[model samples]
Target: QYRLQYKMTVREELYRQIKAHLDLIGINAADELFIFDGEADAEVYNRAVKHVDLWNHNVEFLEQETPWERPAVFIEFQPIKWKAIVTGVEYRADVFANLHVVTDWNEGDGIGEFQLLEKIHEVLAGLCGSNFMEFDIDTSMTNHNHEEVVENIETYHCIGFRHLK
Candidate 1:
């Protein structure tokens, strides 16, 4: 239970930080926005793609938040999941983060989307470091379909578990 709470806090903080960073980069709205419950069951590579399945041309929803104003970013947990290791009397764990940036391929001939993604990457990189939560990005795997392209960035955070407990 404590573990779950800790991870949730981390996720919320991440979401807040992302909003702040995007604000700094001159984006005020998004097409589809959500911080997925990382605990949800699904394949790591397919989670983001799955989330997009929910958005089905809701006019009101689109009026509320337009993706064209800003690209959509889906944040979820990786299937490898969070793991903890016992050491003598201490525990350490990793918080797995899987982020997907979904964009329209036709946006500015795609350069606009690429530029936004780069800014997002920079923002995420600045949020964590070698201090405790090591934010490493793994872009080796990604998914692209139709007008939407899903770019995956995985972050692994290792830290002393007691602090969270």
Candidate 2:
């Protein structure tokens, strides 16, 4: 007899993929935003990533003093819509998410924040894994919240699948 099994959720898998990709790329917040040629470098240096995690969508979350480091990237997922497929015990999920690129802002300079934001979009725009397909950017804009921090939030969407035997 066949049994339905839960391997992993789409949000979880996408989070893992995004983290892994950022880890492999090694984006540091201290580096210069653009090179001399007026272009953002995809691989600036192999500095440690300050922080990357799932966001709770609370603006006040960043307002409070916390241990979070600069050049952080937060991933937030909306409610996933799942539909049962005709294939035995198979389901498809449509996922919508937002990536928040956070960096230090000082004295009217936001180069680092912009650079990291573009790099993230380039690397993750087409990311695909075992549980999900390619991700596409829907929209993005500057998010002004905390005084010392600057953020660029980008929305993305993808389709994922799950099956059981």
Best model number under lDDT: 2
C-alpha displacement of 126 in model 2, angstroms? 1.5
Q: TM-scores, in order shown?
A: 0.50, 0.77
Model 1 TM-score on a 0 to 1 scale: 0.50
lDDT of each: 0.44, 0.72
By summed lDDT, which 10 consecutive residues of candidate 1 come out lowest? 45-54
Badly placed stretches (over 4 Å) of model 1 are 1-8, 27-69, 79-90, 129-132, 140-142, 148-165
Kindly list the per-residue Cα lDDT of model 1 for residues 79-107, writing each as its tens digit: 33334454344344555555555554564
What is the clash tally of candidate 2?
0
Cα misplacement distance, residue 81 of candidate 2 (Å): 1.0
Over 4 Å off, model 2: 1-6, 27-45, 63-65
